[model samples]
Target: MAVAGVLVLARSVRMTTKFTSALDIPVEFVTKNVKLRGKLHHITEKGLEVEHIPISIPLITSIQRKWQSKGLLLVKLAGVEWAPSGMAWLQQELKPKQMIWFQLLGREELALECLVLVNKGRFLSVCLNEEILRQGLGRTVPIKGLPHDSHLHWKLHRRLLRAELKALKKHKGIWQEESYYERLRDRISSNRVVQVNSP
Candidate 1:
């Protein structure tokens, strides 16, 4: 009984432990697919900058400068390459200081590849990766940590592909036809005719 109590206490401590930076996170946590909560700070060309929210443990947190600012985590959405317009869309969709959850998919240098989720309502949470594809604002890419032939990889790939298909079928965003002026410009640039034949 004493051993079980100690084990439970250790697990709780592990769960509540706060990381100072991306490097402070344990490899096992990432591999086990741990989810962390943070506030949306801003979007950059490289990725989303999120301010990690440390778990508050009443008395213990009070001793640890409870009001001190937490460090930012640089996270990239796994399985999607954002388009230029997609960045704009993200800026508009996510408000500053909004609560969000990011599941660690993999780590690359100082940045983390994550599946970013935002609550749309009380019960619905939306995945930004698949949504970007569904909007035709991005293309699906391989998830970094998941093995290519693994079941998890295939499942995620299928979801992303389906989202992309929806956009293709609807002719949305990048899937839409080019304007006449743009098409004409491309044709003129490509056609190098020295002289035109007389009609």
Candidate 2:
């Protein structure tokens, strides 16, 4: 095939990253723009743990600061205060029902409580059960661990770790950003496994 022919035939493919909803928001729309309405439940080293509880004027004032819900999903996404562990500790962190936009979809709504796994300061990987990934996104997959977590999960089998990073970066920037969402978008777009020109 001629070079021009190949160029004309080529199509940019973008791999949409879906969070396995260790909580409830759908992963398909993770990076897409969406809206969410709910009470902010938790913010830990993990991810946002929000509740479907309808907002009330009085309740809003009561839960100004992030508070733990005395329920099964006790801890949502842990905040920098409790867990200033790695790079995520640097995260300004979102507050309950504060209504902040996210790297994922714009949806402020959160599902059940899930652990937000910060991966190599590149991508936000949530540690979810295999079922959520399968059911939420509707697919059969391999290695449920986040890209960065893969190293720990697989015991840092060097070659394997390199392999995962190589593949994961091809998808998007999950960690390490200037904290500017646009730069984050640029890095994810240019450095992803599957690339596409999105609208």
Candidate 3:
């Protein structure tokens, strides 16, 4: 889950194009997708619950300059309604004072018409439409041509982390760099946790 969260970062889309179905009907889509460090809050028969995902220390510091103190959360999602019950469910289940980042992963399926991705489980990746992404954020991500983690150095580091996380989970391996990670991890508790809930 953690690895998926990390891998899913960066390579994301920004809202620009108008969604259309095979019939050329206008459709909605979630603007942006993100997966940050958070904890599971609850679980229902149909959905999983989670909260308080931490961001990379560097990311927050770097993006904080322009984005508001409580960064954008409410975004336009095409073909998907903003479910108040869903948000309220989150508020009730998630731990009080828990802080984490929620990444908007793209639609569940590929087509001109889109459904905002919203998973009810240990982790919830909100499906937001392009309007949401464009409204809250100034950047735009084309649907294609994202820079993949294929460079030699990036691959090597990815491999190393993959191996380490595997070993750590398997047998509780020596956390050689616990102190290093501690220093490197962001202290979201100290900073404001932004929940962008606007369209």
Candidate 4:
């Protein structure tokens, strides 16, 4: 289905005129629909879950400009609500001390939205997204609700796609699990003995 809508980003940073549907509105819509500025509340391999309220405003809590880990950098957020018990599985995998900042990109599906993690004044847009995908944290799905006219946006999109390809080629993260499944299938087939009839 084709639907056209305009979503305004925070501080009037950018405007988007494309959206898929109401169920899966893009980051553009999220910014316009919800509050633009908010604390970076939760982080996981799946996607960052941010609770934006009318009063919540984005606050920068750290000045440490260093990389903490591969494909990840931490930035503290003050006065942010914690993720609920339903997200315990995801929380367990996260480092509570390392609360980073992210920008909503768009929606991938019904419950999941795409985000870009920023670190050291640079956007780890694809790395963070793909790292989660490669590690079997989440599925790599197509996203809509964005303007294709922006060169920068299109560039980021291409980078994300390339990261996924790299993950698949190197058998990193989720690809490793895929390989295991393949091996299991081979073993199962090998154990099956075919009946032979004498000619």
Model number with the top lDDT: 1
Cα lDDT computed for each candidate against the true fold: 0.83, 0.33, 0.33, 0.41
User: Each model's TM-score?
Assistant: 0.83, 0.22, 0.22, 0.44
- The global Cα lDDT (0 to 1) of model 4 is 0.41
Evaluated against the true structure, the overall lDDT of model 1 is 0.83
Runs of candidate 1 exceeding 4 Å displacement: 64-69, 177-199
User: Which tens-of-lDDT digit does each residue in 81-193 have in candidate 2?
Assistant: 12233224223433335432222312233323222333334454433222122122111222222343444334423423343344244432232232356677878877664
RMSD of each: 3.7, 22.6, 23.5, 12.8
lDDT by residue (65-102, candidate 1, tens digit) is 65454678888999889889899999999998999999
Question: Quick one: best TM-score, which candidate?
Answer: 1
Q: Sorted by TM-score, highest first, which candidate order results?
A: 1, 4, 2, 3
TM-score of 2: 0.22
Model 4 lDDT per residue over 50-168, tens place? 43222222331121113111122222111111224213534664554433334444333443333434343354333355444444344444444345565645665676667566767
Clashing pairs in 4: 27-106, 134-173, 134-174
Please give the range of 10 consecutive residues that has the lowest summed lDDT in model 4: 72-81
When 1 and 2 are scored with TM-score, the better candidate is: 1
